[model samples]
Target: MSPKQRILELREQIRYHNYRYYVLDDPEISDAEFDRLMQELKALEAEHPELITPDSPTQTVGSSILEPPFTPVPHPTRMYSLGNAFSQQDIAEFEASIARFLGREGPFAYVLEYKIDGLSVNLVYEEGVLVRGLTRGDGVVGEDVTPNLLAIPDFPRRLPEAWDLEVRGEVYLPLQTFLELNARLEEEGEVPFKNPRNAAAGSLRQKDPKISARRGLRGLFYGVGRPETLGVRTQQALLERLAELGFAVEPHHRLVSGVEGVEAGYRAMLEQRRALPFEADGITVKLNELSLWDELGYTAKTPRFAIAYKFPAEERPTRVRQVVFQVGRTGRVTPVAELEPILLEGSTVSRVTLHNESYVQELGLRVGDTVLVHKAGGVIPEVLRVLTEAPRGQTPVVWPSRCPECASELVLSGKIHLCPNPLCPAKAFEAIRHYASRRAMDIQGLGEKLIEQLLASGKVRDAADLYQLKKEDLVPLERMGEKSAQNLLNQIEASKNRGLERLLFALGIPQVGESTARALARRFGHLDRILEASVEELDAVPDIAEATASAIHQALSRPEMRRFIERLRAAGMRFEAREKQKSQALEGLTFVLTGELSLPREEVARWLEAHGARVASSVSRKTHYVVAGAGAGSKLAKAQELGIPVLDEQGLRALLREKVGQEP
Candidate 1:
């Protein structure tokens, strides 16, 4: 076939595969196979540049001209954010207001849907084909994301037979996909996305339709754009019709007859929310009748017809009794505040993270300060604020100059203080603890308390030391039995085979997170190469900021640090041994990944990092590449405007394998 024909065929095949994998959740070809086809197409296009077309899969990443700021288009019906009711009393008040408005309400029912934590989108369909999609910019007007929206599988490129219609829904990424995508980004030395919501928002705003398509973004239709077209007089009917049209509708939507029922539905949704696939911060309670929605109308920024019953803020107040400093696996000193007993979101709060010295200084917190402590999303406990009036005599907490566990003097590297002594007992304890973490070594029987006991008893001083412990050594320690000791040993033995990335992460270098570790592994491909890297060489790696580079350099230069690394090397720690491969396809290319992917992002990142490419976390003019996955959000759009090259996983792999004669 001619090069032109081959390029077109390759594009068609990729688009079809995208539809199958993203929209249908079924893929006929293996990833490697799909990559091979893409490689062939890219090669053909490169040889005959004249064959490149606007719609070609290879063109998605390099477009730099951004369409001007999105002009606001008026919504047929003004979209409104909901008013939140934080408590049952608040809900009761709302119910009373509704009853008064309706005049002697005999029965009123409510429908409950999970309040998806994502960007809101308005899709316009003319004659059953999607024409344009817009962001819920300001409820009444939004930015056009027509191209990006078209890429979404569930978005319905062609709608059901209808004259004209508009549908409202959320654009989001699934948790599983999010985790995998972030892992890959990390592997490429790119910063992982913060959350699923952010990822979704970024994906929908990409300028290139093809880029958006590559990221597996999906939309769930919830409300109608023009109620008149649906011949629907009630919200319940509108939702049912949407579902009937094959849109992914919220499964828990229900219609209850009155206020009591509404309350019950709200509670029920809250209870079952955890089981849902997507993240939901609250439940949305909307008026069931469309006519009533008009009657209730809207306020300036919110609709009166609907009220969002927000889950209580997961916050609680506790007294700060004292501050404690702890050394992390990387030897960074972290300050933790001990809190007085307080109940918070069903759990007793005793302590919270103060992060680093910078955080503590920002809060101007002191010992004996009464502080509001709460877990952000019922997960990580953090100090929200300090109540100054609670105690005037409280002293300012002093940061320790020496490590608490081992009296090593703390060294300051920019904002963070570090326990630079390689043999510091606390640092060793942290390293060992991290090695046994679920994501690391998967050591099942080793809990923090147990680890503390073992450390206190001097049975294990380093991560490798755990491998040397005898059954009797552990069995005698606190609650450890023969079975538990054996289990722990088995886990340690299993960990010996963990790949280079995990080992790099377990080493706990300053500012070297899981993602950074993966990048280092892929770039250096061996522990010895990394350990021997000078500060300047380390700094040259992508995303290795100045501070982090210096810290790693200083740490490795120490005799103790060298000894530790040598010990690990002697103990048979595995490292990447292959010569660096080269791929001209992605050479001089940089990528910034946003959102989630089906495969672990780390795998993709490793491939790229090893193939003479750069991957970044945030968007910038210097960025040469963007490998957007599902729910890519704003970064995708930003990349397009900046004229950065964007690639899907398949395209990226193909690019890496190009120019077989050279090393990646």
Candidate 2:
């Protein structure tokens, strides 16, 4: 076979194996055989980059874009949240309410499934091929998290039959994966996520797909947005259809009639919750019939046909030994109650954040007070209430007036106390760590120990000082070898090209996250311009608000921050936007691609985005251009009907040559 033909065959084989191993939990080939096939495909793709497809396995490693905004994609049908039922009375009332709405009485068919505490996402498939996976933002519109969703091993990139549909599911990290992730976070001196739900939500929304992939995220489809289109009449049938289409459907969803059966299912789920490999805080009870769903209708927020029956809250008494102050990377001081060790949800809890002085004062807490503690949502351990009414001569929880590490005077910023000292050892270390983080500069060898050593030895005081460190400075540190020191230095030097968005985020600007940084970088196209931008100008950028703009303006205006920027500038780091700098070439234009292309559609997308053009997924009247290729389908016909301009591969390339050229 020719190289192209062989490459196609290898891709098919690898995809089939991926299905077997990840989705089916069975493997036809050994790991070595799989590795060999993957290696061969990678080698071929490396040699012939133009042959790479968007759905290719290699693409799952992640896109190289630093902090690109997830394109907002509207859901075909609204993905509504479920109403909560805390007690048996509430469940009965919900049943009665549904019955009353139907203008009938007695039993109603229902399906009960474990309510997996995780992020809800909608997956859109066109002709059996996965196209978009989105977060349920505002029920109407959602951030397109296709790349991160694709990173999930069990998420089917393609279905069994050639069908177009949308399915909703919970994307969660398994209990084991959550524990491991939390352990890693603790080891890195970073705060652990409160629960698996938070971890899963955080991981799914990660800017980098590779990082999401490493988190071992999993999914379980529960229902379809449009069941009639899929010829499914009941929730149970929808689950079966999802399974038939090679989706990882939620297991053990039982069909029952009336509130009693639903209650039984909920109880069973509660009993089995701890033994399960994932967190289940409740059982979601839904009316099974698709026909009656419309009649049941919905509240403004939640669906009327379904109710989440939550398990009873778990709380136990524990005494506060003392209230201690902890300093975070942001220099915000938090009061934590060092409790007498007590067990809660399979973990020992000795410390819980008091949140602020107001929280402590509200609780009327003292050192000797007994308080109810539990894992809030079976994830974060938190103090519930004080049992004792009287103090009994116990000391009141004291608030500190100065920083615990550097003894710098604390200032109240809004509701919280903050240390303004940039050179404070704790804050400096955190700043350097954040700068070298995988999401930032990604200096691989500068782990926490090396950073602490660099700080303690006075080799580095801030992020800019990191670039100034020589091999001699690192070599003297414990466990630093000649080769290791050189590698570390090389990594640090290589970080200079990480681009302006990453740099902005690394600078630790208050209220500016990775997405906000990207917005600023894309707007101003340079770090210097952003620093000088007026609040009104900053607020003019899409998604940037007045408050965020004010924060950005105020932060850059600080003398310490100004000095830091100068140091960074003197270090020869990139101060200009290096990626996706907007050009007027395709200004006010929007393009949509369809069918087989000579180059990957992603490659075309990158080019369009770089030239100030939007690349939409579906064809609409707003779409100015439709890049049609061989075997173009519905999108092509729609574009033609709407009188949108159509361009072939040759035409697109010629246009590129005339416009943006080979800039990227």
Candidate 3:
């Protein structure tokens, strides 16, 4: 393909996969394959620098490098990234910038979190349920990865109350899990993974969500997309609120004085780095006080109040002892280089991740070859470069042809080999697990251990069998008490109202993601209609392509699947689509809200945003309008200064009615 054509093709493929991975929780290509495509795109972008565009996948954090599987679902608000700080002066300048913007240094505390080396995920919850999980795809538009997120054990599916809000966090694999996974893969004759960060990212982007589930991925939430809604006045309180609402918050955070506190905390963290369970790239310094976040607002892509104090990427010489393939939770086999023990930074390093088959091939890695090893994020080991000279005569590293565990022939999807066996133990547990996941049927008490116990007892055959579960059946299991059993049943009963789209997604049909499910549910209105619909009718549904429609139709047509649906239907599950979304009449319009409004500002903001308005914290010249309330402050004054259109609560309500004609 020509450079331009190749870039376009790469972007198209990346986007499609992003949709599949993020929106659908059903990726088509493996991570290695996706990475290779990305590397090629990056190489081309570098060689032809003029070809680069702001919207290019190369420019976005669509999970580490290769941008979202490729869906472009807009976030309620743009999720901003952090600017970097290399030295103490950079950190000082960060505080100085905040003070300069605020015109004072009053109450400027700092909150520091180890800049986790992982993919950034945004979560949206409404009416107590987590509706969507998205990647930070260019801030405004992110790919939905909710189902994959639901696979994360600690990720809250529902909040304590019916709270409508967004939470942001870093999703990563713990170091011990990474080591164990790599060890198991190596023992099974599969290659080991080199870095935990990419492994975590790749795990989340699997076509089979079971990959994410079985991989034991974890999340540490630290951000509230709009803290204004929660009445949180500081960064530390926001985290505490997250914990109270049932989220796993990183405990390594501290709220202290500006540069000195940050430097001290960073130094302490560095001292205890090896003891931590996960990888942290740097120290994140954020203004502890949240109220001032608006006053000292954002630049184009980053906030002025926050900066990442990055650890230097240093390398050391190491010899490759052996190369091994590590099959990940999603059946993605990545290459890991076993190295002769060498000191890197301060610790002894023995293994380094080669990333993928393409990466290893690119390096032309061989046994006993010298290479430069560095810690990616100063935690995960990565082979920076191959130092060996000419070794053209050496045999190339052997790639696996079959799954290490199941011994099933691997299907080469795109540029990566994947084990397509549905019953592979590596992926089988996910079927029922996903069916009971918070995003799906939402069977609350049905955790992994319980599912394993149930499966071992042979009382449950599939997700459909979950409906057949009895209290007596559970009481006999290991730890399931009468109360636990009753609670589980109640949860299962409640899951019936999760609606058709969630059920369709939980069914694990090939190429059928949440959006497709919603499309199908909306078009058909009922499960019976969808089951009865021909491929032609299915194809005619918006966004359901000919191939995807065919796949859906065929999957639904299967006798076993029919039986599964029948059982679920018999279980009193509701199969219905919500009303089509209201028109985005306020799309492209930016609004800055100010003062204490009579109506809850959170609700008001949510309403405006739902109909497609951008609610910014700080007023800028680009702001289209300013919604001012009672006792308006400096923001109101600024709005007046800039001559931006100002509206009261009633005025805003009238504007919404005029624009959308209803409470959309």
Candidate 4:
């Protein structure tokens, strides 16, 4: 076979094996055989580079743009959180509410999916290639974590066909993996994660893709973001379609009838919940019909068509042997109770966080007190209430007046204690660590120990001084061999080109995260420009509020801070924006997509974007045109009300022809 044909065959074979191994838990080939196929594909691609595609298996690894602050992406359609149901009566009330809304009641079909106690992530695909992975941040905007998602071994990186799709699922860590991870953390002298769900979230949110890749994270994708576009009329069919597309759906998802069936399904799942591989705190009951979902509409925060029926928590009585305070990286002093170890849900619960001073005072928690402990949502250990009201010991639960590490006096920042000392050893270490983090400077071979050592030896007082280090200086440090020191130097030297966006974020500006830094860099183009701009100018950037802008202006305008910037610049670091290449032909125009069109909305959007037009999700006065399909809904009405022009598929085509002299 020709190289291209052979490459395609190899990719198909590898995808099938991947699906079998990861999704079906059944492998059709040995590890060696699979590796051989991959090796052969790589060899062919190396010889014939022109034949490579974005969705090729070789392209899946670290394919995401390594921007430090994950950009906040708005969902094409709103991701509504399900309303909760706790009891049989609540389920009955839910059914009744649906009946009341419909004005007539019968047996409406329901789909029950295991509400995996994990982080919800949205995966977006364009032309069969996975483009974005996002966290469900407030249901409307999600933080982009595409790199982390691409690291998942089983990710449906390339669909079987060139299709536009968005699917959502819970990213989870198995109970066994969670335990192993926690044990590894403890061995490494790091704080253990409270539970699997937290572990999953922490793993997925890491700046380094390697961390997420090693976490053994799994996903159970079920819901299609635009089921109407896919012609999937029911939740059951959607789940099946997701499975067919090589995306794993929760295997036990069921289709049933009535509140009684939901209750029964919940009971069945609850009975087998502990035995299941991952954490399950609840089951989601979705109204199976997609048409009815729109008809029912939504509340401000939750969907009217679906409700999560939570399983009752398993609580146990445990005594607080001692209460102690621990300082976080941000200098928040959290009170932790050292409990007399008790077994709850197969794990020993020895410590639980009091959350804040208010919670400690509310619980009236003391050194020696009986309290109810339960895994919150079958995940983090939480205190329910104190069984003993009165103080049982002389050592009372009180907020510390002084910082534990630096001995600086603590002050209240809202309800939490804050250490005002910028020079606090704990905070200093964390700051340096954050600067050298994988998503920031990405100084490889500069581990936490090396950072601590550099700080102790007074060789590098701040993160900027890192660029001033010589290979000879690192050679003297413990565990730093000649080769290792050279590699470290090379890595540090390479970090100079990380760009102004990462530098802004690395400076640890308050409220200036990845997205905020990106906006600032994209807006100002250079650090000097940002420093010259007023707070009003800073606030003009997207997502940067007035207060945040003031903070940024204050930080950048400081004489000491300007000197720091100069030092970084002297070290040959870049301070300029690297804007992405795009067509700016119709840059000022925005179009809102609604209803179904002749072709996929993504296809039209891509074409428009290539020619410099923007595709927006919502209808507003700013919208240039509303693309209405046969079933155009409220967006079209809103656009009309706002005096925005409406365009059907044919009208859109005519406009494209007139504007760009080409067919959409």
Best by lDDT: 2
Stretches of candidate 4 exceeding 4 Å from the true structure:
1-277, 282-312, 318-323, 330-332, 356-370, 377-379, 386-403, 407-423, 428-430, 444-461, 476-484, 522-540, 550-664
List the lowest-lDDT window of 10 residues for candidate 3. Answer: 61-70
Q: Write candidate 3's Cα lDDT for 1-664 as tens digits.
A: 6899988899888877766544444454444345557768878989999998876766654433244443458899888877667778978877787777778874468898887877788999998788889877657777766768888987888887787888999899998898777654432224455567657877787644656788889999889878987888999999899898889998889888867878888888777766779888677888888877888788655788888887665667777778887665445556678888988878889876666677777776777778777776566667766776634325567888888777866644323455544445565566778677776677888999998898788887577777788899999898878998899888877888888778887776656655567666655767888888999998876556787777667667766567768778898878785533234687678888888977687767766655556666666688898988888875687689889999887888788878888752
For model 3, the superposed segments whose C-alpha errors exceed 4 Å read 1-71, 105-107, 183-194, 318-341, 350-359, 365-370, 376-380, 387-664
Better of 1 and 4 by TM-score: 1
TM-score of each: 0.60, 0.56, 0.49, 0.49
C-alpha RMSD of each candidate structure in angstroms: 16.9, 18.3, 14.4, 20.3
Q: Write one digit per residue (lDDT tens) for candidate 1, span 1-664.
A: 8767778888889877644433333344433345557668778988988887766755432111223244456666666667667667777777778777767664555667778866788888888887778877646566777767777878766765755878899998777667666544432223345456656766666644665676577778788866768788888888888888878898788887666787788788777765666667778887787887777766554666678777655556667888988776556677788878788766677877676676788788988777766554344466767767676426887988988877866766766677766577756766777677776656778888988887788887777677777898988888788998898888777777787778766665656666567667666777778878888878877667777888777766777667876776676666663334333345566767776876777655656666656665567777877878888877788788878888776665565456333322
What is the TM-score (0 to 1) of candidate 2?
0.56
User: Residue 474 in candidate 2 has what lDDT?
Assistant: 85
